[model samples]
Target: MRLIEKVWFNSHPAKYLLVPLLLPLSGLFWLLSTLRRLSFKVGLARSVKLTKPVIVVGNIGVGGNGKTPVVIYLVELSRSLGLTPGVISRGYGGQAPHYPYLVTAESTAVEAGDEPVLIQQRCQVAVAVGSDRIASAELLIAQGCDIIISDDGLQHYRLERDLELIVVDGQRLFGNGLLLPAGPLREGQWRLSTSDLVIYNGKKAKKNANQPLTMTLAATEVANVQSGQCIKLLDFIKLNPSVNAIAGIGAPQRFFDTLKTNKFNVKKQQSFVDHHSFTLADFSDFDDTIALIMTEKDAVKCQGFCQSHWWYLPVDATFSDVDRALLTDKIKALL
Candidate 1:
């Protein structure tokens, strides 16, 4: 883990001593972030309102909070209601030849961002990626998408959104509650109140007047990264109790925990930084005979040199029927 990431995700008594040292920088970040929002709010910087409603799925914290799963869920929900949904992402850790890279199942993670490509493959929806989200949204609009879902751009004030869905990691809910280098928060904790909805990824909702909806990442199946063969997670665990688990996501422990939940004995676990580019050399030390399990997101980047032993676990974000109805009704209201 990187130094900042260790402090950001993990809490220690030393953090209280070290966090104060970074407060000045965090304060400056807060000022700049606040001013940027004010620029749009005061009309100094204009926000473009698209013809279709845009639902933004994002988090105030820096690392993963399972926003992509939420986005996928929204897309599926939209389709059930006869609305075609498109996705736009900032394309983090990806660089394209040009702007507005449209994603397809065949699109490489290098060309389209990993999450966008994953979404395209899984949801089979129109997905576009670029730093300029408006341009990406325009491409989706041209592709006959009725609703636009911006992934991980809650603070992109330039793109006016009808609904803001903020995802919070139930375990690491706003660590330290400070901004930037000092803590995990991208914006102040108060930002939650301005959001249309708050979804807690994992853990049950805390009882409060405005209780946030809860969702859990449920393992669905395991697929061979090279051949596309799939098996039930339970069956996979039964067949191979001792396996090497790998994750290249922002929250690697979450993936490891899921494997444990399914009774898989993860004999060896490796964690790479978020969106780390993988090479065959990275796995040279691993025994090719042993089963290697990875997250679906990481599976995209390793397909070129993946072995038959390599497999990935695919998971779905599951919510209660009542919560699903509430979220669906909220989106329909925007339509």
Candidate 2:
């Protein structure tokens, strides 16, 4: 992790000096964000409500709280409920040819962003990417979608939402509990109460009054990045007792820890900044004999140039029966 992130998430001594230095900037960020939200509330800024109900799955913190997997789970749940769901994302780290690009079988991560492509490929749903989420929602509506799911836009007040689901990194819940620059949060902890539902990624918060739901990312299988062959995670571990792991997600340590939990002998692990564009040169030094494993998100960006030994573990968001029923009932009510 970078020095700033270490101070944000970890209990580093640098926070005593670094946080004080960045407090002014954090105050400014809070002021601007508050004003922007107030603008929408008071009609200075327009907030568009789409024809279909829009569910926003996001977090207050800057890093990944396993929102993508939860999004995929929602898409599948919507399908099971006989509703067609579509996703809209900001397409961070991707410069598409135009606005509101629809993800297709041929769409590359470079064009549609990694998470959008991954969702489209996994759920076979209508996924759109652009800065203008309203335009993206219109595109999905044109495609006959009955419901809209915003991948990560809780703070995007301009696009009005029917339901807001905030995912929290339960283990690292709002480090320092301060705003950006000084902490990892984009908004304050109070934002959680304003949200419709709070989903804990790993564990539920002890003192939360919202009666939050908890979800766990369960590893299902490992697949070759180059080929389409897949095998059970344990089977792959049996074949390759020791492997090298790499992750480019916001919380790379979570991916590494998942591997360890699955009993994989991780020989060496590497982490990169979130949404990092991978190249063949990035893996030049890895020993080809031992398997190289990565998160499914990273695999999406590396598939075109991946070696035969490169593999990726795919995880699914699993929730308890009561939580699933409650979530389903909430969605039904919204519909």
Candidate 3:
């Protein structure tokens, strides 16, 4: 783990010792953030409202709170509602030839980011990547998308959103509950009160005034990266007695724990930083004898360099029927 990540997520005395030093910076960040939001609220800064309503799926803290799966589920729900939906992202770690790049199934992760390409590949919906969320949404609208889903843009005030959905990590709610440079929160804990919905990505618990809905990422199937053949999780585990698991996500332990839950004999494990670009050279230590398993997010980036033994397990976001109905009602109200 990176040094800052270690400090931010740390729960022991060491983190407490260092947090005091960062409190001043965190206070400054809060001030700037509040000022920026006030600028939009007071008309000092402009927030563009598109023709179609926007649903933003984001988190208050850094690191992954399983927002991607929720975004995918939202896309499916949008289609089921008979509304053509498109996605817009900040294109984190992606450097395309130009701005507002539309992602396709064949698009490389390096070109349009790992999450956008994965969403396009899985959801089969139009996705645009750019720093300017408004421009990206415009591109999606030009492609006939009637609604927009902004991935990880809750704090982005420039693009006005009708529905704000805040996702939180159930295991670690807000780490130390301090602001940036001191704790995991990008915004203060009070920000949760303003969200229309709060979804916990793991074990659910009552927090403050909001009764959070629960969402779980369930492994559905495993597919061969080169052959495109899929098999049941049990069948794949039975077939591969020993394989090395590789993950380049925000939380590698979560993916690893999922593999263990499915009874996979993980002979070895490798974890990379979130959105780490990969090449064949990185896998040189592993021979062709053992298979290399990865998450669907990592698989998108490695598709360019074909690997015969490389495989990725696909997962779906699952929620209770009550939560599903409530979410559906909320979206339908917008339409």
Candidate 4:
């Protein structure tokens, strides 16, 4: 992680002292964001147009609004629309691809990032990861991609987008309703107002929204790692009624809640900062035999050092036809 990101989340009171600096930092961010938006407004930095259209699946929350499944849905939706789509991601925890580079199934999570690799495996779409998202889009285009679908980038002003979809956790909505160091918002609420459309997986969209989409994942899916195969969700419940659950996501409880909904016998839960690089010590204090279920994002980092009885339940989201029509119409209006 970058030094800045590391310090931004430190909960020490001394870090709170840095909030004053956040005033200038936030102002500068807003200024840069404003100037970039103006450039698009006046057509200074031209947005590269795709032959088909571009759809971005993202949210303002720092993490975990079920963005991955949404991206997968876009891949399938594009195919259904008879468009060949390519996916772009910033590769937050993966190797830093200085510019856009194509991802492959053999790509390691450490090299290409887990989410992008998972997307590649699930949708069989061209996947690229880099900081310069616009350049990545061009790379995908050069390879004959008809449309571009960016994962987790609504505020990436560099990438000009045709359609925008925001996924908000029904529970968090907006954490503390503050921006940046003060809270979890990457951009303000008004950004949603200006977006082409909004989708609330667990949250409701504004009443004035021209269109809205809602999606939910299946109760469970198979977890594949190591040589271990086909562990039933019920198996965990029957064996450990007072087991501990650990998660490192924007909302760890969300994962825990899903497990409970599936009738897991969880008796305690541990929440880690999102993208936490787990250490051996993290598991030392836990009951050695208790099952450890984690999100796929976290599983990327955990796979190598995982202890006993570890598994990650993969999730897939489903959207209704009505919501699909609304989303398609919004993209059509922009295209």
lDDT of 2 by residue, 1-335 (tens): 88888999897999999999999999999999999988988899999989999999999998679899999999999999999999999988887999999999889999999999999988889999999999999999999999999999998888989988999997888888888899999998888888888899988654562658889999878999999689997789899999999999999999999999999999999999999999988887778899999998999999788889999999999999999998899899987
For TM-score, the strongest prediction is 2
Query: Which parts of model 4 are misplaced by more than 4 Å?
Result: 1-25, 96-98, 239-242, 328-335
- Point out the higher-scoring one by lDDT: 2 or 4: 2
Which of candidates 1 and 4 is the stronger one according to lDDT? 1
Stretches of candidate 2 above 4 Å error?
none
TM-score per model over all chains: 0.97, 0.98, 0.96, 0.83
Ranking by TM-score, best first? Answer: 2, 1, 3, 4
lDDT of 3 at 8: 76
Question: On residues 97-186, what C-alpha lDDT tens digit does candidate 3 reach at each position?
Answer: 899888877788888899999999988899999999999999899889999999999889999998889888887678778889888899
Q: What's model 1's lDDT at 270?
A: 88
For residues 1-335, write the lDDT of model 4, one tens digit per residue. 23333344434454455556676767677777778879987988776655556788889767778888888887887787777789999887787545677898677677787788778866789999998788888889888888889998787766667888888776667654556765567787777777766777755555755366677776555364443465566664566565667788766778888887777777667878776767778877677666666777666666677765776777777777888787666655644
Per-residue C-alpha lDDT of model 1 across residues 1-335, encoded as one tens digit per residue: 66677677777666877788999999999999989988888889999999889999999998678999999999999999999899999988887888888887778888887898899988889999999999999899999998999999998898999988889888878777889989889998788777878888997775441447999988867999999999987788788979998899988988898888888888899899999889998898787889999999999999889999999998899999999989988988998
Please state the error at residue 149 of candidate 2 in Å. 0.5
Residue pairs with clashing backbones, model 1: none
Quote model 3's TM-score.
Answer: 0.96
Clashing pairs in 3: none
Question: Considering lDDT, which of the candidate structures 1 and 2 is the better prediction for this target?
Answer: 2
Note the Cα lDDT for every prediction shown.
Answer: 0.88, 0.91, 0.88, 0.73
Best by lDDT: 2
